[model samples]
Structures are given as C-alpha cells and as structure tokens.
Target: MEGGLLFQFCNWSTLLVCMVIKVPQIFALLSAKSSRGVSLKSLLLELAGFLVFLRYQSYYSYPLLTYLEYPILIAQDVILLLCVFHYNGSMNQAIPYIAVFLGGWYLLALQKWIIDLAMNLCTFISAASKFAQLQYLWEARDSGAVSALTWSLSAYTCATRVITTLMTTQDLMVLVRFLIMLALNIWVTATILRYRKTATKDE
Candidate 1:
C-alpha cells in the first residue's frame, strides 16, 4: 500500500474508533436525561466548526474518516438537543435554535473558496463557545452532561493528529485545522482537570 492509502486507512480506523467511543456520550445524555449542564451555544459553535471543516476538507484529499466525523457529530448534537429540551421541559423554545443552526451549517457547507481571514475569527469564536459549555458543566455540577467518551477519543486522536499533520502538505488549511483541534483538546482536558480539582475542594 502506498503512504496516502495507508494514511487513509488509519484515518478511517480512527474515525470508526471515535464514533464507537462517542456512543457512550449519547447514551449518557439519553439515560441521564440531563442536558442542563451542556451549553446550547457550544453545540452551535461545534456545528459551525464542522461546517468549516467540511468545506476545508473538500479542498483536500478527504480520507474516509473525514466523511464519518461530521455526521456522528451531527447525530450526537441532535441527541444532546433533545436531551436539553427534555430536561428543561422547553422543547418548543429549543426548536428555533436548532432549525437556525442546522440551516446555517447547510448553507455554509456549500462554499467553494474555502479560506478566508474570517475563518480564523469563526474558529476562535467556536473555541471560546466551548469554554462556555465548560463553565456550565462546572456550575451545574454535571460532567454527565459532557461527553466523557469524546474526551478519551480526543486523547487517542492527539497522537494521530501529529502524524496527520505530517501526512500531506498541499492544504495548509487542513493542517492548520488539525493542529487547532490538537491544541483545543489539550486545553479542554487541562481545564476539565483543573475544574475538577477546584470542585473537589469546594465539596
């Protein structure tokens, strides 16, 4: 097998691993019935990030793994959305947000000129939105609302990302995106641990 094909295979394998691992998160939301701690804005931001990633991926090789990721994310987000509304008993209120975000992502994913200076701004905003979600989890005393399995999958993917960064050099955007993901995973993990310690002390 050539290097590109081999890398694709690895990417697909990792993607499969992510989906299977993320199932626990979906189950946690469903079984616990508590999306109260998760931030709606964070899901919106993630949906936006994946929309950007999908457009950027189109300009590059797009391993099979790329195809798997966004759909799984979409599914989990849907589950989380339902859980959030269910817990709040505000299903009607959540509907507009969902429709707007879904429609926005669909529209954004259609672009051809993949890179713009605005992408950096959008990506940073998305990252900051995850911080909002983190704060909610801490304030509400609910790690159950967050995705534990996604964390484990991220830990695994961190190494894979380093390799991926080395794999292809055509699309600077793709490389940059993976590196951003790598950095976000590191920061998110550290923040979670730090918050856990503080919460532990308060208790």
Candidate 2:
C-alpha cells in the first residue's frame, strides 16, 4: 500500500509540474497579437487524434479518470481547430485531408472488436501531432505572433506525457516514444528561447 501511495505521489508531482509549466500555453494565444507563422499540420493531426480519443472515452465507458479534462479538451480543441483553419493558408488542400481524417475514424470504428485498436490509433495520432508541432516550432525563425504560453504549455505537456509513458511501462516501443517526445520538448523549448530573443531585439 505504501508503494502505491508513493507511485501516486510521483504521478501527481509530475502532473503538477507539467501543468504549471503548461499554463503559459493556455494564455499565449490570448496574449499574442496573431499566430503569424505557426503551421496547421499539427493542429489538423491533433483534431484527428482527438476524434480517436473521443472514441476511447466511449470504449472505456467514460470512466472517472477520463472525463477529468473533458471540458478543458472541448474548449481547447475548438479553439485549436479554428486557429488551424485560420492559419492554414491552403484551405483547398487542407480541407480534403481534414475530411479524410474525420471520415477514416468513423470507418475504422465500425469494427466492433477494434476498440483498443482505435484507442491505439488515437495515441499514435496525438503523438505524431505533438512531434510535428515540435518540428515546426524548431524550424520557425520568427514567432512574433505565436504565444509563448502555448509553446511553454507544449513543453510541459510533453514532459508530463513522458512521465506517464514511463510509469505505465506501456510497451516495448514506449522507451523510444518517450525519448522522441523528450527530444521534441527540449528542441521546442530551445526554439522558444531563441525566437523570444530575436523578437525582443526587434522591439
């Protein structure tokens, strides 16, 4: 029992640290004048993954642990979807992909025994989305309009995810996955600093 308590404590500690650091992302868009050069690819992918997450909720019977962030996710995802569309300079090509993503989820879920498969797909999707965003942030030279809060949140969120992945001992690939996310978080955190430096210089 003591061991369980210790595990729980460790999880909470990691969660708190990540959440506090992630708060900035929640406010970044609000504080920024615009989202000048942020890409939509990750957002699109996240939305796609979110659909799978939604399916996971249903598969898990919407357990107590799941709905913990339902409202937060709904609000955040709505805002992100809008932001993606707004930032996506190429609506013509983007829409088709987005549509296909949505359509594929419904099609995939049709198999009754595939609930776990669906959930796994969602995890893969969200993971891919975050990594893609991290890459984009790394490549971006000017974050003039992007919110610091958002990137900070991304870093912290990835941090928490790393902890969770480690704790769960999810699978053989979990180590690789955690390392990849850690690298992305570190890279983006560096990007945030570099961009902030240049942005400050302009002012």
Candidate 3:
C-alpha cells in the first residue's frame, strides 16, 4: 500500500510538473524576443526522444501512468519549437523538421525491432540533446533568455520518473532512460545557473 501510494504520488507529481515545464523557457523567449541561448537541435532531438519513448510504452501496453507526461511534454516542445523558429526568423525552415518527425513517428512502429533499436538509441539521442544545450551555453557564455527554472523543473520530473519507473514497470530500458535523463537534466540546470550567475556578476 505504501509503495502504491508513493508510485501514484511520483507519477502524478511528474505529470503536474511536466504540464508547465516548458512555460518558463517559452516565456523567456517571448519576453526577450530572442532565442539566443536556446538550441534548436536540442529541442528537435529531445522531441524525437520523447516520441520514441512514448510510442514504446504505448506499443508494449505499459501502464498509462508511466508515460502519461510524454504527450504534454511533446506538446510543450512543439510550442517551444515554434517560438524558437519565430524568434530566429526561420519559421519556414520548420517545415522539414515537422515532416521528418511525423515520418519518424510512423516508422517507429513499423517493426518491433525498429522501436527496440530506437529505444536503445533513445538514451544517446536524448543525451545529445543535453549536450547540444550545453554546447550552446558554452559557446554563448550567457544564459540569455534560457530559463534556469525550466531546466530545474525538468530535473525534478526526471528524478520522480526514476522512482516511479522502479515502482511500476521496472523495465530496465525505461529505468536506464530516466536515470540518464535525471543526470543530464541536473547537468543542464547547473550549467544554466552558472551562466546566469556569471552574467549577473558582469553586470
């Protein structure tokens, strides 16, 4: 009974946090009228990772609670992507990206092996997304419009997922993904805070 309640708490809490996880970043962009510190590649890769993980869970009939937050995360990512494109004055360039993502979504379930392969690769893809963001921050040396709150909340969600995954599905792949994501999210959050501090000191 205790474990069940803890699982529910973690799952619901993760969902609740995910619902607004990207808001700060989106608001930051709109308020500043720039996407200076955001990485388009990171967003795209992260979207791809989410799509794969969500589809994998649904395809295998995993518990709904385990992956429920993914749709919300994906939606926010789409909105965030549009914001980034709009600010970068490259909205037209978004067409190809949209097309590819749609195509990949369909292809994910074409064969069981394909998704298995994708899931195995998902960690690297998601990790690449974090690295892309880290690279952006390193190059820019400025947080710019990036939201530290967004990344911190992301880390929180990931940490909760780690607990929920162990309590529920216990799928090694899923567990591994959450673990990697939790670490990367923390790393990104730290990087964002560091840059923000440096920028403040310079001012």
Candidate 4:
C-alpha cells in the first residue's frame, strides 16, 4: 500500500511538473514578441503528437494520472501556435489550418489500429520536428525567440519522466517515446546555447 501510494504521488507530481515546465515556453514566446527563433512547424507537429498520444490514452487498459494532462499539454502548444500567428501577423489566416489539422487528427482517433499507427507517426514527427527546428536555428544563426530556459526545463522534465515511467510501467513503446523526447530536448538545449552568440548578434 505504501509503495502504491508513493507511485501515485510521483505520478501526480510529475504530471504537475510537466505542466509547469511548459509554462516557461509560453511565457518565452510571449516575451519574445517574435517567433523567429522558435519553430512553428515543431509546435504544430508536437500538437499533433500530443493528440495522437491522447488517443492512445483512451485505449490504454490501466488508468494513468498523467493521461489527464494531455489536454493541458495540447493547450500549451495551441497557445504557442497562436503566438506564432500573432508574431506573423496572420492570426485569421492560420485559424483554418489549425481547425483542419485538428479535424483530421480527431477522425483518426476513432479507430484503435489507426490511432496506433498515428501514435508512431506522430512520435516520429515530433522527434523530427525538433531536428527540423534545429536546422532552422542553425541556418538562421539565431535563437532570439527561443528560450534557453524553456529547453532547459524541458530536458529536465523529460529526464524526470523517464524515471517515473520506469517506476510505474515496463511498456517498451512508452519508454521509447520518452527516450526520444529526452534526446531531442537535450539536443535543443545544447543547440540553443551554442548559438547564443550568433542569435544575440543578429538581434
């Protein structure tokens, strides 16, 4: 009983931590007043990734406290997307794109097998999305709009998640997903710091 309670405590704490970590990124975007350093594609792809994960949650036999956190994660991405739109001065034009993407993803959630496939696809997209963004950051030689604190917190959160996941479940697929996220977060954090000089010069 003690172990179970501890596990539950860790689970809830981690979920709350994840939510709080994302807040820094949102604030970073808002403060930057430009999405120049941040990758809009990455934000969108991650939103899709979270939706796929959310669908998978419905099919997961065991109930998880973190499952409830998916919508909050998605909402963070949406806010970032809106920030992107705001920075681009194209909020109205971007609305339909967001709507259509959500509609298509929602349809895929209807079937289990499709959701399974989509989860993998979106995970890949989410991983690749960070790489794509890194490429943009490299070429642009600017990380002005990207927050080092955001990536720092994200990397730390991903690491915490890996530990929590291991304690609770032995699901291979889930482990792989978190591992990928951790790797990407580390890469982004490193890339941001490496380019700090150039990004500052550019600004």
Candidate 5:
C-alpha cells in the first residue's frame, strides 16, 4: 500500500510540475523581450523527443500514469517555441517546423519498427537537446532569457519520472531514457546557474 501511494505521488507530482514547467522560461523571455540565451535548436529537438516518447508509450499501451505528463510538457513546449520565434522575429520560420513535427508524429506509428527505433534513439535525441542548450550557454556566456527555475523544475520532474518508471513500466528503454534526462536536466540547471552568476558579477 505504501508503494502504491508513493507511485501515485510521483505520478501526480510529475504532472503538476509539468503543467507549469515552461511558465518561468516563457515569462523570462517575455520579460526580457529577447530570446538571447534560449536555443531554438534545443527547443525543437526537445519537442521532437517529447513527441516520440509520448507516441511510443501510447503505442505500447503503457499505464497512463507512467506517461501522463508528456502531453502537458509538449503543449508547454509549443507555447515556448512560439515565444522563441516571436522574439527572434522569425515567426514565419515556425511554419516549416510545425509541419515537420506534425508529419513526424503521424509517421512514428506507421510501423512498430519505426517507433522502436525512435525510442532507442530518443535518449540520444533528448540528450542532444540538452547539449544544444549547454552549447548555447557556453557560447553566449549568459543566461539572458534562460530561467534556471524552469530547468530546476525540469530536473525535479525527470527525477520523479525515474522513480515512477521503475515502479510501473520497468521497461529498460524507458528507464534509461528517464535516467539520461534526469542527468541532463541537472547539468543544464547547473550551467544556467553558473552563467547567471557570471552575468550578475559582470553587472
């Protein structure tokens, strides 16, 4: 009974966290009126990873609680993406991105092998997203519009998912993906904090 309760807590908490996961970052962008430190490539890659993972879970009929937060995460990402494009004054470029994402979504489930392959690659794709952001931070030397709070919350969600995935699916692929994501999220959060401190010191 205690284990069940813990599972529920982790699942529900992950959902709650994801519901507002991107709000801080979105607010940061709007407040700064710039996408300076935000990486569009990272955002796009992250969104793709989310889509692939969500579809894979659904296709395999995993427990709803195990993957429930993904839709919320994806929606938040879409809003965040729009904000990035708006601030970058490249809203027109968003069309191709949307088209590709939609197309890829439909194609992922076209065959079992495709999604299996995608799931295997999902970890790397997601990891790449993190590295992309880290690269941007390293290059820009500023956290300008990147919210450390958002990344910290993301790490929290990933940690909870790691627990929940072990409790429920126990799928090795899913477990590994969450583990990688948790690590990457923590790394990104730390990088953002370090850059923020440097920016403050330079001020």
Candidate 6:
C-alpha cells in the first residue's frame, strides 16, 4: 500500500511539473516576440503526436490524470504555434494549416487501423520533432530566442517522467518515449548554453 501510494505521488507530481514547465516557454516566446530559434515543423509534428496520444489514451481508458495531461500539452503547442505566426505577422496564413491539422486529428481517430498506424508513426514523429528543433537551433546558432530555462525544465520533466514511469508502469513504449525526450531536451539545453548570447539582439 505504501509503495502504491508512493507511485501515485510520483506519477501525479511528474505530470503536474511537466504541465507547469510549458508556462515559461509560452511567456518566453511572447516576451521575445519571435520564434526565431524554434522549429515550426517540430511544433506541428509534436502537436499531431499529442493529439494521437490523447485519443489513444481515451480509447484505451487510461487514468483520468493521464487523460487530463495531454490536453494541457496540446493547448501549449497550439499557443506556441500561434506565437510563431503572430511574430511572423502571418496569422492569416496559419488558419488553413490549423484547420487542416484539426481536421486530420478528428479524422484520424475514427478508424482503428489508422489509429494504430498513426500511433506508431506519431510516436516516431514526436521523437524526431526534437531533432527538428535541434536542427533549427544549429541553423540559427547566432540567435538565442530558444529559452534555456524552458528546455531545462523540459529535461527535468522528461527525466522525472522516465523515473516515475519505470518505477510504476514499466511500459516499454512510454519508457522509450520519455527517454528520448530527456535526451533531446538535454541536447537542446546544452546547445542553448553554447550559443546563447549574454544579450541577444532582436531579429
């Protein structure tokens, strides 16, 4: 019973912390007023992955806590995408893409075979999204729009999730997912530190 309670504590705490970690990234994007170092492709791919996971969780009847967490992540990714559009003064251009994304998300959940395929594909895309962001960072090594604090928090969240997941669930897919996230976040954190200027010039 005590072990179960401890597992519950770690699970809730990790999810809660991960959810909170996005707030700063949102604010950072807003404050910088640019998404110069961010990868829009990565954000879009990650958004799709989030939607897939949310639907999968719903389909399989995951715990309510897990169900609730994905929406928060989805919302944050949407906000991040909007920030990108807002900074680029291309809100008009974003509408169609947003519509398409939502449309695809809705349609994907309807077919079980598609869902299974998307589940695997989205997982791979989600992991690859980090590399996409890393590629963007490499391309824009002169800029410091990517927030170190945000990525650091993300790394911490991923690490926490990995540990808690290993201890509690021991599910391979979930374990691998968070492990990749943790590694990518650490790489981002290091890249940020390496390239970040003491005072970044505005783009």
Candidate 4: list runs displaced more than 4 Å.
1-6, 198-203
Instruction: Indicate the residue-level lDDT of 76 in model 2.
Output: 67
lDDT of each: 0.63, 0.56, 0.92, 0.75, 0.93, 0.75
Q: Tens digit of lDDT per residue, candidate 2, span 74-112?
A: 456556555545554443565676678667767756776
Q: Give a tens-digit lDDT track for model 5, residues 111-171.
A: 9999999999999999999999999999999988899999999889888888988887789
Superposed model 1: Cα runs more than 4 Å off: 1-9, 59-67, 109-118, 137-144, 193-203
TM-score of 6: 0.86
Q: Which portions of model 3 miss their true places by more than 4 Å?
A: none
State the TM-score for model 5.
0.98
In candidate 3, which residue pairs clash?
Answer: none
Model 4, span 53-90: residue lDDT tens: 77776677546674666777777778878888888888
Candidate 1 per-residue lDDT, tens place, 105-160, comes to 56654554433543555567656666766676667664544665466576566456
Taking all chains together, each candidate's TM-score versus the true structure is: 0.74, 0.63, 0.98, 0.86, 0.98, 0.86
> Candidate 1 or 2, higher lDDT?
1
Which lDDT tens digits does candidate 6 get at residues 1-203?
97677667766776787677667777877788777787888888788777887786676665666446678778887888888889878889889987987898788778898877777676688878888888887887743567778788778767766766666557677677778878888997888777775334432
Residue 38 accuracy (lDDT) in model 3: 95
**TM-score of candidate 4 on Cα atoms, chains taken together:** 0.86
Of 4 and 5, the candidate ahead on TM-score is 5
Candidate 1 C-alpha error for residue 18, in Å: 2.5
| Candidate 5 Cα outliers beyond 4 Å, as residue runs | none
